[model samples]
Target: MNPVDKNHWLDGLEASVERHLQHAIYYFQNQDSEVLLKPSVTGGWSIAQCLEHLNRYGHFYLPAIDRALQRHDGQPDAPTFTSTWLGSYFTRMMQPETGKWKIKAMKAYAPPPNLDAHAIVAEFIHQQETLLALLSRARRADLTATRVPISIATFIRLRLGDVFAFLIAHDERHIQQALRNLPVSQDIDVQAVR
Candidate 1:
């Protein structure tokens, strides 16, 4: 990915987070547990499973980001964020554009067959709220200098900006998948989900 203005990048990510939060509130939160737990027509994960999967990721990345930010040395925020090669690769891989190859969730990240939809949706909303607050706090830290370890591979750390980009992209991918699992009658405007 090309370099982008730091504030611009953060603002875009914040907007994405807000959209996800609203989708959970307006759509998922109101759905019946049976609807959320129904198996996908395509033999994929159910809506509740998708959300629980994302919540699992949030369980890892959110605190990782918070800790990285807390440890920041009070350096001035960078004017621009340049994605590292690996970071860009991961972000692009996570995007849910049509025809993209699906990546299987690692065993640890996979959601169980039966989950309570209400709890999963509530947890997702709470995590997004936490993420929004963290993003606000991030404006004071150096995006490039601060590093967050990846959940899959803790030994490898990426620039904080890249972690934000990759994490949001992953969220969007799964949320889109969750939307697909919805009954056609309850279908949201697909574009709005993005």
Candidate 2:
């Protein structure tokens, strides 16, 4: 693991998130043979499908956050979740540490991989903007001192202090999964001219 400074965790999260975004764009933009479609891998979702899965969380959960935040009578009383909350399912899957004794289910809520790709991509940007806006509008202390409402999992809430980092780590996990699905080696003749 690369050594990261504890003091500037938000900065580190932002940097990693950007790098992951760059790679994800490249992965999707260029099919490059196996990347676009490969069923050989066991129980693997195609890159397109993976992108779809990633966006499902954003499309569904971020809006839920907005809705929950809106329900507050006072200033942004961060979110409090129960076992029945839909967002909790996603927060667990996209969670940073795996099986680290988090109060999340091992199960994933898979949406059908049939959404329009362009629309999904467009909405992803909008979702990110919405999240950032919510964070930006929050008081600095809320982002720092605020921890995620569910304590059974020990997950950090997106206070200004932790929001950026959480986004970055969340993006990184999916990015790596997409990369791993790519074929390790495809026989190509370098000697022959293209």
Candidate 3:
């Protein structure tokens, strides 16, 4: 087995996410914003654009979870995977493998003309910190019981033990994409997560 597999899955993922975030913070701190924000390829999101999209979408899981947590009220009970039409769609979305969906969605984002890399990185850090706060407050039981907002048949193969695992993977997936989309940043090297 890979050394990564030996670690509890979400624990390994959380460590990776922290490392990735450190690289991003350092990159933004030192990088020349104009160069990083400049359009790299004709048909792609620029670094600033990619960062904006990640900032917006990485919280996909947390808002709903926060609502549930607020209502959790210390009872042994919490909501199950109840499917509203929108909820079903949410489930379908959160169910994809390590960002197969995120890449597709990222392709669809175009940065507005006025935004700068500085704004994008600032937004990214703010959003990531919010997500980390949510995760820190999440109870372990919540992690296990939170049914993925998905159909069982879809998840049976992965049988993800909890929502936290999925959320951690979600962050890492987008972080990887943003790193790839970034035009070279100041001396920092953010190798793609293997």
lDDT of each: 0.89, 0.46, 0.51
Tens-digit lDDT string for candidate 2 (22-53): 55454455554444455427675565555666
Tens digit of per-residue lDDT, candidate 1, span 12-128: 999999999988888899999999999899899999999999999999999999999988857667788888999888888997773299788899999988998899999999999
Selected candidate, larger lDDT, 1 vs 3 = 1
Ranking by TM-score: 1, 3, 2
- Score residue 144 of candidate 2 by CA lDDT: 30
Using TM-score as the yardstick, the better of models 1 and 3 is: 1
In model 3, the Cα lDDT at residue 1 comes to 12
Q: Between the candidate structures 2 and 3, which one is better when assessed by lDDT? A: 3
The TM-score obtained by model 1 is 0.95
Q: What's the lDDT for residue 117 in model 2?
A: 49
- Kindly report which residue stretches of model 1 are placed more than 4 angstroms away from their true locations once superposed: none
Q: On a 0 to 100 scale, what is the lDDT of residue 169 in model 2? A: 46
All models, RMSD in angstroms: 1.5, 9.0, 7.3
Give the higher-TM-score candidate: 2 or 3: 3
Instruction: Supply the global lDDT for candidate 1.
Output: 0.89
**Model 2 — TM-score against the truth?**
0.53
Looking at candidate 3, the ten consecutive residues that score lowest on lDDT are 1-10
